[model samples]
Target: MTASLVLAGFGFGSVAAQEDATTPRATLRIVHGISGGPEVDVLLNGEVLAEAVPFGTVSEFMPVAPGDYVIQVVPTGQPAEAAIVQADLTVEGARSYIVVALGTPDAPEGRVYEVNLDEMTTGMARGRFINAAPDAGGLDLVVAGGEPLFGDVGYGDASDYIDLPPGTSSLDLRGDDDQVVSPIADVTIEESLAYEMVAVGQVADGSLTMLTLSTAVDPSCSAALGLGGAIEDACVRLTHVAPDSADVDVHVNDVVVAEGLTFATVTEFVMLPSGEAQIFSVTAAGSPIEEALITTDLGLDPGQAYEVLVTGDTEDLQLAITGIDLRPVPAGQARLGVIHASPDAGPVNIRLSDGTAVVEGLDFRGVSEYKAIDEGTYELQLSPAGDDQSVLLTSELQVTASIVYDIVVVGRPESQTLAIVVLTAPVPVQAEAIASPVASPGATPVDASGG
Candidate 1:
């Protein structure tokens, strides 16, 4: 199957931000708060501090010498002379600060806020509010249905740190004459922790929003050590491979999880409740859930991910469920998996176009173990087991380092529609266990099925 590289779980890479406790330097964090802004690079004193930072991103705190410095924001990969916004700020030793790039891309603005990192009174949490919304003038942050917490905060300005009772509290942003501008709900304020809330976006277009940035309370900083990207909840993606089926909707527990999924297309991973039986159904687009063409009950485990393949013809749709491993592959290697989903193409063998056998006797509904292979391009050929005279499918696969490619053999040979569909995922820090048959050359095969 010929496939394009699909980038998943993309985010800014963390620059090394930890400094020795004895270092006489101030910590600085750059935040991308500009509405609809391009990916940018943050420069401190003419040097790049963070690279390729996208909107709504808050960087890890990096230590810098306490003194006056020039800050610049430029489009990522651009020259230093192309900075769209520039400002001068001074920071004190042993203190923390945040620089927010706000407003539109054409007319960017910056706001600086001094953060309180000092120890707080027991049972109380602290928060600093910054008004980054260029159009929301004179905002008052108040407890929802209660009193004001920070009053008359102007645009590009910050309010004094306010002590809040520990627990979840909702707040409202009020404008002139105490008119409610926006209601932010379910804010968690844990005791002994500090937070910064920045009001951003344009108020005239109803895009005014707040970003709550929290600081780690423990020195371990486990929450900051790339653990936030781990998959703690179970997720499943649905791929419509039934060649003759109409556009369909996937329903999980009577709720539509994916709508109008066309043939050979896959949906983004949908989060689902795990550790219990889930009722799954498929119906024609715009059809009621009761009119399901197929229904199945399955239980998924937490901390794992899955792919549900809908194969076969419209008259007899089949579901092939397979768990996928997302853990990172060994350095310089690529992971490969194969699934035999074509009902008409009975047990088949796979080999390189140059005559190197890779898999043998893989039957319908069979899924192969992910094999570690050297990253490169390969021409793959498949045919009936031990019969090289009849080549059923051949395609070129380009494998990149640290990527996982799962190829699904699909379509009906009788209708001359046989082909393959390739799905890919990036290497992640999380690992999951799954069972499937088939393997690369020299590896033992496992006895498993995807149906």
Candidate 2:
């Protein structure tokens, strides 16, 4: 005889009254026929009664209304196959019944992994590290919307973990020395859930540094201030306020025109020729503040000077200004340089002053060495291997005679979709500066080591 059990209803209300007004009621005692592991599911009348049941256990479903009802026995973790029994059984007011749950064949086992985060000490921020991509190296971590609890520190290993004060936060994991990574945000690090950080490196180089040029404009001056104008004309005179001595690069539009100008005074004049309208940009070489562009129009005059106050974007960070000059390039030459924080490798071009291409097919690694060519004043453009991927530098570089200049490109990582972290420029070669009989027309190719 099968070992069956009955489930008698022990309640204050009648089972028949609890059922649909016209339907009868029944009580059920379900039992599993065979089981090694305690994993089973019981469903009654098309509704799942229990999720998982223990082996050889008897579960009671009291006061079940009787009707054309179906009973299903499903093995845990297996939903495709189940045993069903359909019968029309009526239950007397106090009658009890038994339900035999026949077990099916066992199913295959699945795998899962658990992730955990260690509790952080007080006053410390909660932090985690992940290695999503197994291949790349040098991940850049960015904390958006707030300052990092821990200042600029490198995470060397892919699978390594870091500690921070427990709280809700988002993080980005980038490669190429933090130049390219993924942003992971809105991660709720509950006291229970273990946080797993993944690190994925960028496929290409990452943009590591940004050069920002900040200059306050006089509200009264108006003349469409920028970096381009007539030959031998002065665009804006920028007074040097920091780093008594340093090297600077001047950019008209986005194309670099001159570099390596040493400055040792408080006032520096940046000269631009007339005829073309463009924005003027400047940046220091080998300094943390490497690139800066003029976003506002300078409304410059031929011989007027613009006083620019230099300050650090953050406290404790030094404001170093290098290189300053006021000059114009001769016609037929174009000034050029690499975009400091660009993400890809490709050809860089310059529109000449004489409706011709001054520099063509110039290749640059982001953050590498920059070169300048003597092309007449026109619009400068940078294209990355294809016509669809080109960014026009803001101004036309008015080329004049005899004046050498530097152009610095400033790109910020936060503003870009892709980040490049590796060094893209050629290695700089060391050489002594030899006095040439005549200064070169465009950017004089300095020793590569100077990059």
Candidate 3:
């Protein structure tokens, strides 16, 4: 018998399919949608449902006893007692569903969606669309040179189910006035299978893209995102901050990276290939090749993001490079970076109000890389070169999952007015690829980064 199982009380999830009363079992598939999260194992009532389900992996449908089941997702190989996302899942006999492990890893939110598969015949394929872009406005999607497949789709909205001829299809997304926003070509859809196509991330940052999910195996789907949305290399943005510096042109190994850039201008990140050292050069806006002003070398690692900010005065230039980790944090975890930016402060150590040292002997304008920790209100203290008892500055911060923060020393240690400046910025959307360049007042924002 055909039917749709609505999870009205259990998080309002919906499951649609046919029921086989004689079998007395429910069919289930799962999709791993938590970006940056580690592989996870799904369990029901202390029983393993699936193991080591990695990011971007999908699972097929399997039969299970129908009733109210205690559902949980934990790191692969961990004990069942340790769960990351837990919920109560109800499955009716012979029904089917797609349970998706989504949201940032630190604050996971799993979703249950029921799909109907009665039209799996004559080489036909079933599909639906979802909009997951964080800030994209209404969008129009169409087949290559064909009628609209999805029109005016808003953020977080899913479209009606559709039937299409199985195989690879070329598609493109458009904004207002039908202007092409992104191209999603060469997507393959197999016959006799159900699928969900999603457009997720921020469009302006070049991370807005697509993914095609299939519900056959226990939790199966395609790649993370396309339309060139996912950045697989080191990312960097340059900013020019010297107060007395002229409108300068920047270069990386003789190639003009950004030209005619004025002070206080922070350019959007320029995608860079990782695993190599880069030579950055600066010259007067209209200067000749041989008369460059300054140069610096920076090493960028793969699967990470970095920032190179030009600091100090126009005559004595400096480059401050810091790495930004966009990897998913475990559930309930947060990340922080401490920077020593007090121009006149001597080498100082960072610590907590309770006398725990976090950074040691950091010199003027130095920085501590980002580190993960449990979310909480941290009372920070700056001491004289690791001497926690000699607290110089203090600040309290409340951190949350998937959020990054920069705790900066803003005044001279010897100055009675010394204090800590806590700057907070949003995590890079799904791409999570960005860096922050900290600049004090009387300075500008010209770093190969932002904020």
Candidate 4:
């Protein structure tokens, strides 16, 4: 039988697909921790397991039968003969493993470590450290103002799992001489879970950083089971982009969460329990839920991030939900996506100034996948899908390294309030600073409509 697979957000949760309890199977995942590396694909016995996985991104857990198999890693799109790393992996039944592709871009290596999923003491967290940093030799994983959690970890070595108290604390990677190699700030160690602290990148080039991976079923989902629910929280953000709509109050499940939210504003991520239908209502500021202008029932999945856009004019407003991928970009690159949210704008096309199409025939409420691109400034043209001659907007898009950007096409066509609003995902604090001309504000959205 084929392995059961489940898509995950930031790699959380257990085997979602149902299987026989007596079947002997193992779950496996791949972590792309190679610093400054090109996107790579993981193949198991000639079948593509994970495709085009960029640096610092984790693959979804896949269950496979217990056996010895040929595991290979190659630059994405390359043939099997071009494999950079290849080995035989023996997976045992009823266990989980994380195969990390580490080292530099030119010279890569792979290491497999079994995750600690065994039951542990209450009120404690289990963690381990892996030294993937090629140049940083003999490192120590320590909690700030505390003793070392894992010490003298050599390159490519994995430490045994250790239990720690649940709390928030800063983490540090120190060198053999007791010098700090990298400091990870405000890491939360939740009770009854396990984590992998991987030290990646090169010390000489100042690309040293840490990647934290969780290997547990989300606790929120467990808590939901106790509350007669079956799923974890879904991360939702609200963006008020309907230019002509009056200031409004937003309600979820009959509770007013945002009041007097005006145009061009957005709410932080709201954690709402999933596995049930949720009522979302919008009304005039200070108005009762009975007077809601629009009410809809939304069912969301656990462990996913979604952006809900309030679009169109007040008379014919609508809600549009777009899923956001929070995976990290590879070193020296950026992830960009486009959302067609304008009410009056029909199907549109986005192209570079040189007439290269970036997105084509994207209709209202359509969302594009986040595409990776090199860091630079470029002129972009937006126009009606079929009629390319009549350009609707022209603007410069500035993007920096290691950032994710989502550009929303907003504003009504008649009132000429058409524009593009940019939303950015936070950069990884443990990342090395990429030397680029782009300033701190990595991406800026220009007024495409000349408003």
Clashing pairs in 4: none
- Sliding window of 10 residues with minimal summed lDDT for model 3: 218-227
Runs in model 1 deviating more than 4 A are 1-232, 429-451
Q: After superposition, how far is residue 95 of candidate 4 from its true place, in Å?
A: 24
The C-alpha lDDT values of all candidates are 0.69, 0.34, 0.60, 0.70
Which sequence of candidate numbers ranks them by TM-score, best first? 4, 1, 3, 2
* Per-model TM-score versus the true fold: 0.45, 0.19, 0.40, 0.49
Query: Candidate 4, residues 236-288: lDDT per residue as tens digits?
Result: 67888887888988888887667899898877555565545777898988999
Q: TM-score of the candidate numbered 4?
A: 0.49
Which structure among the candidates has the greatest lDDT? 4
Ranking by lDDT: 4, 1, 3, 2
Tens-digit lDDT track for model 1 on 297-319? 87776545578988776787878
Give the per-residue Cα lDDT of candidate 3 at 404.
58
User: In terms of TM-score, how similar is model 1 to the real structure?
Assistant: 0.45
Write down the lDDT that model 1 would get.
Answer: 0.69
